[model samples]
Each structure stands twice: as C-alpha cells, then as structure tokens.
Target: MSRLIKNLFALIPAFTYRRSHLAPPVQEPLLANNAADSTVILGAGIIGLSTAYSLSEMSKQTIYIVDPASKACVGASGQCEGAIGDFGVENELSPLNQLSYELYQQLAEQQSGKETFGYSGMDVHALSSHGFNSSDPHLPWPVQEPEDISNLPAWLKVPRGWVAGLIANQTHCARLDPPKFCRFLQKECESRGVRFLFNTTALSAATDASRRTLTGIKVLNKGSKKAMNIPCKNIVISAGSWSEKVFSTLFPSSRLRIPSTEQQPAQDWIRLKIKKPRRSEAGTKGSCQQIWLSADSEDLDIHMSSFLDGEFYAAGGFVDLSDIPDTPDKVTSPSHVTDIIEQNTREFLALGLGETVQAVGSGRALLPRLTTNLPIMAKAAWDDLFPSKTKLQEHSSPIAARPVGDDSDVAGGVFVSTGHYLDGFALGPASGKVVSELITGQSPSVDLSNFGFPKADEESGDSRDN
Candidate 1:
C-alpha cells in the first residue's frame, strides 16, 4: 500500500478513540433566492456566517448569503490557527475582540462547541528560531521563555537553540477548527432559515433613487451566468479580502474605495492541516497552544496551533504582498512560500508521530490587511455605494431618506463589514452580532463609529483600489 494509506491505517486506532464523527458536510449545490428575504450577506466566511446567525436570532428574517466560491471560508477563515484571543488586538477592535471571546463561550454552550468544534482554552507561546531573520510577531512584546521547556505542550518539540515563551493574554480562548465552527454556525443559520447561494457573484445594488435606499442586489450565478435581483431591505459586505473588489464592482461609478488608499500591503500564506495526536494522560495537554515561530529578525514568518479535535493547523509562509486574486477561489500558494513553510510542517508532523497523528489537508489564504489590522463596519454614503450594514440614523448620508422598511426618519441600506485582516475568526461572532443589531434598527452592541467607509464625497481625490 502507499505511504499515505499506511499512515492512515496506523492512525485508525487513535482516530477511533479520539476523533468524533463530524456531521455530514453542509451542501449548497443548488442556487435559490427569495424576493421577500430582507437581507443579502456577501461572503460566507466567519463574518458572513456570524452575521446571518445573529440576524436570524434577532430579527428572524430570511437572510440570503452570496459567495463567489463553491464553499464557504475558502480564504483566511479556512487557513487560520483558530486562536481566538487578543492576538492582533487593535484599539478599534478591542471591544469586539473581548465581546467575541465571551460570545464564543456562550455559543460553545449553546452549540456544544466544546465537544463539537473542539473548543478549549489555548495557551499562547512565542518561539525564537535561528533559521530566519526575526521571530517575534508581537513586536516589542518581549520573549519570556527561560531555559525551561517544561511549560510547553508535550507534543511541541522545538529545535536545540529555540526557546518558547508565554504570552499573558487573559482571554479564555480555545481550539476552534475554522471549518467545524463555520459549519456549526452555518447549520444554526440554516435552522434559522438562512439561505446560502454558493458559486454566486453579487454584481451590484438596486437602489431607489427617489428614496436613496437599497431595494435589492443584482447577483449572478457563476455556473450559468443567470442573474437575479435579490430584493432586500439591507445588505452587508462581509466579503473579507475581496471587499475592495466587491465595493468597486458594486459601485463602478463611485469615488469610494476600500482601504481608501492602501495603508498597508497584504500578505500571502499557506496552511498545513494535519491529524493531531490524541490528548495525553501525561497531563501536558493543559491547553492547546498557539505557537509563534519567529527568527531573530525576519519581518514575519509563521504561526501554528494543535487542537483537541485531533487536528493540527499551522500557517506561516511569507512577508510580502501580491495581487489579490479575482476571487478567493483563485488563491493558490506560491511554490517558494510553500517550500519555506513545508519544512516546519514536516517537523511538526514528525513530532506527532509518537501519537500516530498524520497529515489530513493543506491550503492557502491571502492575509488582506491595513496599517490598523481592523475590520471596516460602516454605512455607504447614499450617492455612491450600497449602505449595506449600518443603522439608519447614525450613518445616513446627506441624500438619505426612508429605507425599504420605511423607518420613517432614516435612509440608506448598504453596510460595509470587511477588512478583518487576521482576526476574522476571533472577532467574527461579535461582528455578526453588532451588524445584526445595526441592520435591524437596534443600537449596535459595540461601537463601530471608528470603522467603515468615509462618505463618498469625503473619499474623493485620493481613492485607489487595494
């Protein structure tokens, strides 16, 4: 038999005892739309799924999600270490970051995530390597590991000169398999009547010129080029890295652009997913660990995490930006980047051999970012873009009038919620909750006044595509 088959046979004993049967994969082979559905969520990543989950729970309105990919979370969401904490906490995202922590706990209970998605507290560690230029991701966040390696997870095996240090992140986070968590959210959303349209592209917004409100979205099924106007009272652009393209495509005539003028370049990453060693009775399994692999001085390189669900995820590839693929589906790992990361991945897999855990899958993601590394949550100015996911009163533009629901005092329907750089998985829950509240006429749970797009007129003169 082949080596892969032999490895699988060796792992079956561990798998039988430690691995839980995941539910049948969620499917969306057929596309469907309803005119009466009041909301269209673009992108089916963590943010979009969370938005739909929150919307269904709060308003109980039919929510439709559109994505250009055949499957959800084909970007960063699919590749992250699932470290749900203050890893990349920015001042603007602080509230949502903490709130998402708490929300994860509650959702874990509600969804049995601890058992379902392998939720458990994660121990954060920073490691230094002699292999590259620099190792610390939390620049200025000092290294604290002494000569003692006892504090690290038993499954973690570092090289001779490498040292491991702990990060004092107080938030209670755990192992969250992105695919499993998203499926859980999607399952919940489906139960709440949310519809997902995969392999679909949102072309633009349908507006009421007299009222300055978004009445619908023009979406095209990529499989057949069959376009349909999904009538809705509101829209949320939780489109991740594709936010710029989504915004520009939806408003080719607008002066507004995502990231406005490109404050920072985006990086590319490759993800290595492998079967994890079963929990050890030796007691070192304390909390799953988020390992930051860095050298004495490279800009950025790698990060990894092992989970309770018998799965391991590690992502670290490059420090440069590239052209954003037309869609997340088109993203592929460059050969050079993969070469750099695979050495470490192979080492990690070797470390797990004592437990018989093996490789399962591998993938890539574009880490779209800005100088701030926070998501945009704003209302599109009436004249330019669709005010997709905003509260009417707080963000209405000068031309704003009554929205589709006729809230009477406010107008605008396009709300933007993207640019979540690296924290999309951690921040997704609270982002969804707040976006749900905003679109449903409730005050947002967290203040997003500082995020999102500038008014169309304010965004003129310097607008450049990301």
Candidate 2:
C-alpha cells in the first residue's frame, strides 16, 4: 500500500508557474505601525520557510518572511530531489544530520507528511561502475530491501560496467516531491500566523548606535517600486547564494562577509514516463525504482534516477559560474542546458533495456552554495561587524574577542543559515529548528560551535567553518 501510494502521488504531475500579474504580487502579513517584536526572514527558500514554521511554534511574535521571488521555494529547496537519508554519520555534522532525519520523522507524524508532502521510507538502490563487487562506498551502508537487481523492469538499466546494490534500506531513507513539500511547508507556516512578503527585496538593514544589533530592514516592492521600512526585533538571512549580497547591502561598511566565490550552481532536471507501466505483487502499477550512478570522480557528475507519479525522475548535471541574477524569478539556465539531462535520461533507459520512454518537465534550478562547502549557521559576531580600531595596537584578535556558544536574546541581532548546497533539502529542517531554538534561547539540538562565522585570523582561513 505504501508503494502504491507513492506511485499514485507521483502520477499526479507537478505544477508550473503562470505569471498572471503584469507585475509581481504585493507583500502581505505586514506588521502594524511601531511594531518591534517581529522577525524578518530574508528568503522564502526551504531554510527560511522551515525557520519560520519552527519559529511560529516557539514564539507569538509577528513573523514575516520576505523574498524577492514572487513565490516561495523558487530556488534550490523548491527544486531539490527530495531523496533523503542519514547523511554525515561519520563526519563533523553527524549529530546535525541525525537530528534532522529524526525531525523529519517527527514532522511527518505531526503533519501527515505522507499525505501533505509525500514523505515515505524507501530503500535506495546504489548503482556503481566501480566493479562487479562495489569498491569503497561514498555513502553510509544500511540495508533493508534485499538485493534484487535481476528482477528490475526493462525500463530500468544497469550500464555495461555498472552493478547495482542496496546501499540504504527503508529504515534509513525516504523520498518526496520537493516542490509539493515546499508548498506544504509554506501553508503550514501561513497557518501559524507567519506572513509572507513575496516580490519584496530586502535592500538593507539599519543598526543601532552601537552598531552591534539590527533595528529593521528596508524592502522595495518590485511591482510598485515603493520602498518601506519594516521594523523588527531580529533578522534571519537564509538567502542561499544571495546571502553575501544581503549582508553587504545590510552592512556596507562591515568587515564581516559571507564566503562568496561561487555563484549560480544549477541542477538540470528531467522526468521520463515509461511507454508501458509495469505491475507489482498486488497487480498495482509499478514505477521505476530509484538508482544513482556516478560517471565521473573528478567532476563529481552523477546520473540520478527515481520514480515519482509514474514518471522516472532524473536530476544530475552541474553548471558553473553563470551570472547570479538579482532575483529568483530572473534566474535561468543557459540554452540547451537541460537538453543534456534529457538526452542522458533517454540514453540511460535505453541502454540494454530496450524500453522507450517519454521525457518531459525538463528544467534547471540554481542552487545555493558556499565555497567552504559548510553552512554558516550562527549569529553575526557583533565585534566582527565593527572591528575595534585599537585592536591591532592592543595586539588583540577580533576573532578571539567574540562570544562563543551564545544563546541569548537576539532582541536586536541577526541569524544566518545558508550554503548547504545539495544537502540543503535534507538539512533545512534541522537548520530551521536550530534558528528557532536560538531565537527562543534554548539549547540547539545539534551543536553549532564549529559552524561559526569565518574569520581571516583562523589558520584554515575560515573561522571554524564547515
């Protein structure tokens, strides 16, 4: 029944945008005059939305999510693969990964995630061309579904040099429609009194006299070209790749900066439908099982395969250094970029499979990334933003002067949560929970001591980064 439900949900097609407005939509859920207890989140991507959703449960302060995009999740999170599993088990972020995976389970139970966001556990079949017996694995090993590569449908293929094996079983992993899950999160956030300010750009931030804390932000309505000040108690920047721009604009003279060498990393996506649907044990429609195979090691390019709503999903291909646009709506792929993904998808299904499929719903989405490949999930260091002029004379390090493990009231501060790259979808919930915990002055479920703001003084050139 679970498999049946998954296929059924996948059969329903994903939605596309239809811009009905000559201009973008108006901002909403604006706080009343003289309000100073609200938090303004600086992006509607998954991280910001998740933060808002989690924050709503912890506080009654009027929450406003501001985004330059007309709608939420138009960036990385909205277009994620939604394939989730226990990641970082052996790394520094293991606790964070495990905490997020558990939160996903808890949230699924609380929100009927299966129905709301199509969350369900599934075994991940890993395909590799390394050898007959797999070599050193890049992912953690957890098996629930027994290996049955021989029984795979004709539409699925095991390339000439590749052999298939179960890497993660149902107990450790799951998949969902990312777009659907994002919309579901947005609705949940809205229901909890979180107001969304779509088509609104956060121009800059105002700080108090001490230059230590935030006062509010100035946002411009794209449609009306009108700028307004929205007073807030705190600020959260989950602006993905745009975090640096927001930070620079907010604190023009601040020495602090988000790592920003990378730009406009995109994932080319395509969906294929089998000409003849296969059947399963109970005579229900069987979609193609998920398979991921890396074709390159240096470039790290992999072919992604999964089934959603009767369509085989493939999303893997990386583009580098495209111009990062001013807004999410303005982001686009280079011509024929998705054609490569579509071409690859058709070729993979036909390789030794002799099955024909229809490829559709092809597009590319710009992803958020950090050069350090780690998330900056901490509050802005008050000292870093305003370095003491006498610091060098006093021989004091600004980085050392900053506070550590601060869980105090942000009454006039800001929080930054971005640069998860491909793991953004899986990590969004935990990041949101942590930010909410920070705002509420509670101990974070995952320790963020290492994921602090980067400082030039650090030997690694990034202060406890990633």
Candidate 3:
C-alpha cells in the first residue's frame, strides 16, 4: 500500500472508536455502487461535514462529501487535542467567533439527550510574569509609553494579565470531544440526506469555461485506485493545513505568485530551561519541593495543572509571537518547536510541579500565528505582491474574498467559512450557517461584508492578478 494509504488506514481504528462503536473492518466498501450527489464537499472534516449539514437543511439540493481517509475526521480535525477557548481571538472577536460559541452551545444542549459530542466547559487562565513587548519592532501593536521595571523582579517585569479567566467568566468557552463532534455532525448530515464517501480521493477539480468556475472533480477509490469523474455545482474545500494544495491546483498562477499564507499564530520559538530534582530526594514524600524562578519569566499560554491541598490549581506564562508567519515551512523549524516546548517546561519547573516530567506533544495549529494575543477578524483585498493579507474593518477597501476565492471569481457563487484556527470547535456551527447563506444567495444572519468579495472599483489599484 502507498505510504499515504497506510497512514490513513492506520488511523481507522482510532477514528472508528471515537466516532462510533464498531467491530473490526468489514472488508467491504461503505458505498459500493452509490452515485454522486448535486453539491459536493471536498472534505470529510468538521468544516466540510458541517457545511454539508447546513446545506442539506437549508436547501433542496443533495450534498455529497468525499475524503481520501479511511474514516471521517482522521485528518487534523479528528486528532486535534480539543481545547475550545476564546483567548487567542479575544482582540478580534468578530461576529464569526461569537456565532461559533453560540452554535457549540446549541449542540451541547441537543447532544445532551444521547450524551454525544461530549462537551464540557473549559476554564482559561492567561498568565504572564512579563507583559507583551512594546518596543519590539516586529510587533503589530503601536508602542505605548515606557514603564519602570525597577520595582518588579527582572524576570517578572513583563506585565501579566488574566485574559482567559475574564473570557471564561464572561464569554463561556466549550471544550469538545472532537471525534465525537465530527461523528455527530456526520450522522446528522447523513440523516438530512447528505451522502459520505469515505476513502474516496478527489484528485483534481475541473473548471468550466472562463476558467474561473469549477465544474467537477476527478476522484479515485482508495482501496482499488480506480478513478472516476463526478460533476457538481459547488465544492467546499475543507481540507485543513493541506488546503493550500487544493487551492494551488485550482489557481496555478495565484499559487505561484500569491502563495497561501501560513496560519500558525505563534512562531513556537521560546527557550526552555529545566532543572531536574535531585535523585536522592526521589523517595521522600515531600522533601525540599518547590518550583521557583525570578518571577519575571513565565509562559502565559501553557497551563500547569497540579495537586495542591486536595484541589487542582493551574498556572503558566504567556509570550506572544510578533506576527503570524505566512508560510508553515518558515515557522515549523525544529528549533521553533523545541523553543515553545522548552519555554513551557521551564514555566512548569518554575511552578515546582511534579518531580519527573511525564510527557510532551505538539502539532501545527490552524489559527493564524498571533502576536497581539488576540483573535483577528479583519479582511483585506487580495494582493499577491504584498506577501500578506491584512485584517481590516468591515468597510475596508478591497474586501477579502473567502479563502475559497480561488474559483470564487469564476464560480461567482462560491464562498468559504474558515480560518477559525483554534476557534474551529467553537465557531464551526455559526460559520457553517453563514456560508450556507452565501452559497444560496441569501443575506447571512451575521454581517459578513468583511469577508465579502471586493467590487470592481476596489480592484482598480490592483496592478496584480492574484
């Protein structure tokens, strides 16, 4: 089997367990002779399936979802360590993120009947020994007045804030069992007449005249590698992290010139220094056990859960990235990953947590790597030469087209609901509904002009074609 296929199937056991109670493989296709439907969704992740569910409920058109995976959510959505807090988007809490939180609330209530989509309230605590960097030239924020660090310890000189605690007390974020959530949406969509084609790979999207609109897709059966062509009126690209690949094929020129920007909000480049406890004290119940630091150095985002007086208390530090890198490869260096983890571990040591470090795990994020320590909701016009898209206001000129803009200018009917990043779990429902409105030519319940297509006049200054 191809390496890709092998990796996909290897995840089936884990995927099946999370979504449903299933026996071993049946050794048969889920849909042997089923035919394609009208509206085809190109992914089986939360975004794709959620989009399908919304379309199935709001329109008369049939919906079909195709994925190259052995089961649903096996990609980024299924395996993500689901944490649904709003701290990252606090600065840019657009209507999009707000709506997402609401949808998650509704799903929580509905799923209560079956205890499906295991949902829980997440408490967030944004801690920092030192505040954000004001003079750092790379930061997007304007420098404020200088302040004194003389009274404070050198390490704790950075200002600290409880951003997460405030959000939890005020906004109420929900944590989801991602696998369960994906399955719930899948079953719900299927019940509404949306068909799923697991293990079915879509190789390419074929467009009609004008070369701007998509007409159909060329796909293959994963097990047999047999190819087929399925036509459709619309296609929603929900392939996460890998989305650029699809978009590149759709707009080769844009791919070469414009480039899909990296969405990781932080560079993951903080340094970590850990001091191991003495082995002689290992057998003691409570020897000289205490984590201490200069009180200036702390990672605000990484939390440490510890046992204290029969209760659990969490603490950590925060250090924001200066800007969201435009290329994943640029920010995903080994040192970058090591720095983030090390910094996080350093904070744990400072807290005097457990003696021996238990474990560590990390992965790429979907959210734009942030520097302002807040969510971004602005939109800007497409400019290939600019190297980056700006998050401007709703009335900003050159309104940003949806990420699915590759064929949107041609399809004229296409729209997208993405960039939720870490907010995907909270915002998927609302985003799905809004996208449905755009797809059906109806006004969205929310004001989405910030994400709307730009007018001809707005494009006048654009000497670029992307």
Q: Which is the leading candidate under lDDT?
A: 2
Q: Candidate 2's residue-wise lDDT over 1-466, tens digit each?
A: 1111111111001123222211223446465554466889998887898899899988888888888877877765655567666742455556676777788888889988767776766545656556323343332243234355674444565667666666555566677767777778887887787888777888877765333456778999888899989887688988887888888887766677787544546655666666664432100123225565544463334445454455566665556654767876666554476566666666666432454666655545665655555678987755555455324423644334445333243355778887666567777788899988987778888889867776664313332111
Determine which window of 10 residues in candidate 1 has minimal summed lDDT: 4-13
Compute the lDDT of residue 197 as modeled in candidate 2.
Answer: 79
| lDDT (Cα) of model 3 | 0.42
Residues 301-395 of candidate 1 have per-residue lDDT tens digits of 55666666545555553344455566776766565665666566556443445444344544455555534334577766654443343335335
| Candidate 3 structure quality by residue, lDDT tens digits, 314-354 | 11222233443332222232445445555554444423444
**Which ranking of candidates, highest lDDT first?**
2, 1, 3
Clash totals, every prediction: 16, 3, 27
Superposition TM-score, candidate 3 onto the true structure? 0.56
Name the candidate, 1 or 2, with the larger TM-score value: 2
For model 2, what is the alpha-carbon lDDT of residue 303?
49
**By TM-score, how accurate is candidate 2?**
0.80
Error of 2 at 86 (Å): 1.4
